[model samples]
Target: MAELRPDSANRHRTRVKIVECAARLLRAQGAGAVTTRAVAQAAGMQAPTIYRFFEDKEALLDAVAEHVFATYVAGKSLADPSGDPVADLRAGWDTHIGFGLANAALFGLFADPGRGARSAATTAGLDVLRARVHRVAAAGRLRVPERRAVELLHAAGTGTVLTLLSVPPEHRDPGLADAMYDAVMRAVLTDVPTLPADDATAAAVAFRAVAPDLTVLSDAERALLSEWLGRAGTGGDRGQRDA
Candidate 1:
């Protein structure tokens, strides 16, 4: 790799400093506190200097949210997966709840649909969730299609956190998060790792989980297999719901 030029290295460090300072302001004083002037003063730079690194206050705030959330995601991704995929999934849920509660301001920033849609860190977090769901499906524990399980878990987790955050801490139900998790798990998971022979949907889901890794299949074959399996899994889900 080519070495960074001196000017480029200094610019990078300056940008990092601005982001860190803005993040501190955001955590302590919320989004309203993270103005360009405030961040510039906090970082020991002129206000104009901030413009060199960020287009505007909105851009600076986005960077701050991404910086803090990326750190949390990095730590979360480093955890060793438990041998039991279900346990790992539960652990991930717990961690997500904890992170949201701890970083109320940052979490609220992400709660905004417009900002969240454009967030790279948010996408990375979902990628982690997708991987965990894949593991559960591969183990034959997922009753729903992997995509459905991931969406249910994500939606439930987000709603639970938002609900808890809306209430006063003193009045918040300590068990609410756990209850939501249990409900979502019931909707998505099988009781046992070994799926029933009659459960064609779950069998298709499990097969779909491992389809990409089947070396004997060509790329086109695996893609076609996955498409068929997805239809089977989702069709069963719809039928069950209708029943």
Candidate 2:
């Protein structure tokens, strides 16, 4: 093995420290509380040390969101790849629910609207879902949309997940959550007609180019968004009654 460079090792350690600090702050007080200075203090490093690894707060937040989301996706990634579309979709949904409930802080951080384009987790998750829809549409299991399915799904699913996670314990029900999600997916898939081969491919390409900026907002912005989402999340009796 090659000898390790001191500079490289130092850089790696600093990056890890920053991420750990950011994660801790996000967990304790939500994403809006994570600031460069706060994270540096938490990690026992100087604020400037964080800049050596991340260009700015947005980049650092993006990196943390990516790390957390990757863990979430890996836990739910398909294993068999047996070409069974429905099973694959269900597996993905189950993984999503499991991860969201277990890592609510991380989940909400990514889902917050203010992150703009830096939120790689939200972007990649939607990309994954869109790809699945494309494949299922190809095999005649689902309909295509006149408009892009990805955009529609993003709006609908984001609102749903945020709402579901905010439900009070006494009002939460896992079975109902799953059923509602299934129902929504089914309805969308049925109502929208599939595109022809060329159109489907084109639509897929367009969506790929329209990747959402998934960065979490500054600590202040996240606090505001989280508060709003928390309130909006509690208003529904729909599927997330127990979420």
Identify the leading candidate in terms of TM-score.
Answer: 1
Model 1: per-residue lDDT, tens digit, 133-164? Answer: 99999998888888788889999999999999
List residue ranges in candidate 1 displaced over 4 A: 196-198, 236-243
Top lDDT model: 1
For candidate 2, lDDT tens digit of each residue in 1-243? 886599888877778778978977876787678888899899998888888889987788777877777665554454545576656766666666666666677777677677735665566677677666655544444533312444555555556566777897577765665665676576545433334453443333223222222245566665555344323333432342221
Cα error, residue 115 of model 1, in Å, equals 1.1
Point out the worst 10-residue segment of candidate 1 by lDDT.
234-243
Residue-pair clashes, model 2: 17
- Give the C-alpha lDDT of model 2: 0.61
- Which residue pairs show backbone clashes in model 1? none
